[model samples]
Target: MDRIEQFAPPAGTAGTTTDVGGVIERMRGFRSHWPPGDGVAVFNEVYLTVTETLGRHLSDGAFRDREAVSTLDVRFAERYLAAVDTAVSGGLPPECWRPLFQYRLHPGVRPLQFALAGINAHIGHDLALAVVDTCRTLGCAPVDLEEEFERVGDLLVMLEEQIREDLMPGPDLLQVADPLTHLAGAWSLERARDASWSAARMLWRLRGAPPLAEEFRSRMDAGAGLVGRFLLTPCR
Candidate 1:
């Protein structure tokens, strides 16, 4: 199957809506469908919390360019929403998301790992596409959206730290030699953030070249998925 075949939306809702609220609503619906502690639900709860925070920040004039921020946020969110709708309807998620969906309930994986893995896929793959989508919607260059992108990225970084604290395993599991600790240390949201910024720039550069752009995006998606699979490695 194609790399993105994993992210196909359900046949009925496939790209049927561009409304941001609709996307969040769908996520909420999905959240309700599963138990709170379920792997997918755990990540969804963290994500929904962050998304709501962003919406509040946007409402209070936290952004320099409200229109641009709003556009980027919506576009960024739609990609994830599409993935959920697809998965719920029985479609495959994207390569970057396969590992999470496959191992969402693994007994060996902790909630913190699930959160990080989900963030890895979303920020690593979804954020870049969101940037391109925003640029297209705003009729501007990627440079024009840099400030907003950094702002969103900064928010995400902070939220990630907060999530770590909230989802951290108990003191016993925090041992220096614990596999979970090693796994947690193995990935860095900061590094992922930097890489995503570079990927966005690179993708924007190739926007005019369809073949090259597709190739780059596919590589990015696959690479991110590979990282996600690693993050989900059972560590019991």
Candidate 2:
């Protein structure tokens, strides 16, 4: 059996009320396994903040369909966790996740780069599939989950801004001439979200054709991986 398969929820299982808390705990556990300066840890910290915020919002009755949103969030998180497990067990993760795991220990990559690269892999690749997974588990269509998708996406956009503010270099040192500035500017979370939505719709439409769906997913995985690689370019 694949190493990542061990983390998969049982067939036909939906996200439970405890799933969000479980996700938070798993992310926290990564901190103990990896130092603050580790590339994977850098991204894990940023993701933990977003997950914690989402959990709070779920508790506050922020969504129209809390169950659907919660399920989507859990499904979204499981993909990254699966990839992490796969890498830890000496198995290859998806193309979109390879860059972060491979360069996780490289000293030259900055924290901000690690954060964005992980975001790129998650949003640019995993998110669309998560949407599809949620739709399947809920027995609903992608259109049915639009509200939940937007609300979750809004949280991500806010987090992306905060990540830049917190992780980016000081303005005095982040001039246009700096390669880091250009590298950071080259990717946009908003654009990634839009593209993921389009991909989700496409994947949904292609669901009946498994071969085509896999092909599209493979292409997306490779493309996101390419972007992640470029984002991780070491510029010390």
C-alpha TM-score for every candidate: 0.90, 0.92
List, residue by residue over 1-236, the lDDT tens digit for candidate 2: 67334333333332333489988888877776566887888998999999999999999999889999889999999998888766776779999999998898788888999999999999999999999999999999999999889889998999899999999999887777888898889999999999999999999999999999999999999999999999999987
**lDDT, each prediction:** 0.81, 0.89
Which residue runs does candidate 1 get wrong by more than 4 Å? 1-20
lDDT of 1 at 214: 91
Q: Model 2, which residues run further than 4 Å from truth? A: 1-18
lDDT for each residue of candidate 1 in 1-236, tens digit (9 for 90 to 100): 55334333333443534555655666676665666666777888888888888888988999999899888878887877767665655778788888888887789888888998899999899988888888888899889988888888889889888998899877965878877788788888888878888888899999889899999989999998999888888878
Q: What CA RMSD would you report for each candidate?
A: 4.0, 4.7
Top candidate on lDDT is 2
Residue 191, candidate 2: how far off, in angstroms?
0.6
Residue 84 CA displacement from its true place in model 2, Å: 0.3
